[model samples]
Target: MDLSVTGDPVLAQDETEVHAGIYLQKGTLTLTRKGKDFVAYHALVMFASANATPWAAQRVKFTATGPDSKAVEVTVDLLNDSWDGPRAGIAEAIWKVVALAATAAGDIGITYAPPGRT
Candidate 1:
């Protein structure tokens, strides 16, 4: 993927996928994940013994930091904006954060520990 800085003076949208050589916020984020510059985090919450939605609207909340070292919390909506299903047969949960346009917007690594595990 050959990338050339576009002369267009418009900011890229958050939905822009970060492909190889794709233009990203210069001097900010990287093109890969893992050990990435901690730009933000999505604190996935899972109830231990619950059978319904915790509050009603479960939004993915994450905090991103810019070059200035200031953190800003960014909340993204879910597919249907609701998760009122049970947790017994749920295989896994997946969430995606778009191009945040932060000083450095990188995908935060996510891991699940079930209900009982250290």
Candidate 2:
């Protein structure tokens, strides 16, 4: 399994009004089975800043790629918006969800859970 982040250079125009430095950045996390590596599944993530809104999960996307090069994508709606700790913790939670979803869908052999939970 391989994971990587891809960034979009363009900043979100509307979001920049509230959060000046926010970019419409994108990240791609790919999972491939060890023996059958050709069939890869990907999770494409776009994070929206809570600097503008009070939401926990901004946005997330999961993509699956088959051998025929056909791709299917699902948009995930995360509803864990009760965070009152710190702004920095939001990124960690978002990433953990991304990993758990990607690995669960791809069936990549490894068990993944958030830091404190199973």
Candidate 3:
């Protein structure tokens, strides 16, 4: 996504908060605190497993710095049997973080106004 905050000549330094809810067939995904200038953070918890596989709830948290930093943190809660399940959980976490960031950046773009343009 093109998440540039420089195009708007009148952007402010205040932090902005953005959130997104992602619904997948087998998982309840949520992305929050996206975009803005200082940081973007997200958390996801998978309550159930796919196809009765008995997976545990997975939690992931990430913080991105500035309007360009792609910093991310991920945490997963899984049963021993599912801990190494093809890295799907980690992948999902990463995806959610990016999605959250994009959503936030989009919001910034939509709400941005050059200091003297409006």
Q: Which candidate is the best by lDDT?
A: 2
Q: Which residues of candidate 1, in runs, are more than 4 Å off?
A: 1-38, 42-57, 79-118
Judging by lDDT, tell me the better candidate of 2 and 3: 2
- lDDT accuracy of residue 102 in candidate 2: 37
- Write candidate 3's Cα lDDT for 7-115 as tens digits: 5476432433233333233223333334444333444433333443432233334333444565544344332455543233344544444344444445433232111
RMSD of each: 15.9, 14.2, 18.4
Tens digits of per-residue lDDT, candidate 1, 1-118, equal: 9988866674443322222112223334322224445354333331122233121212344455644566655444432423443234222331212222221232322122322221
Using lDDT as the measure, name the better of candidate 1 and candidate 3.
Answer: 3
RMSD of 1: 15.9
- Can you tell me which runs of candidate 3 are displaced by over 4 Å? 1-40, 49-55, 59-69, 82-118
Worst 10 residues of 3 by lDDT: 109-118
Q: What lDDT would each prediction earn against the true structure?
A: 0.32, 0.41, 0.38
Model 3 residue 35 lDDT score: 41
Candidate 2 collision pairs = none
What is the TM-score ranking, best to worst?
A: 2, 1, 3
* Steric collisions counted per model: 1, 0, 2
lDDT per residue for candidate 2 within 1-118, as digits (tens), equals 7999798775343341120112122334343444432322444443333444422233465555645667655454443545332234334645565455435433222233443444
lDDT of 1 at 56: 21
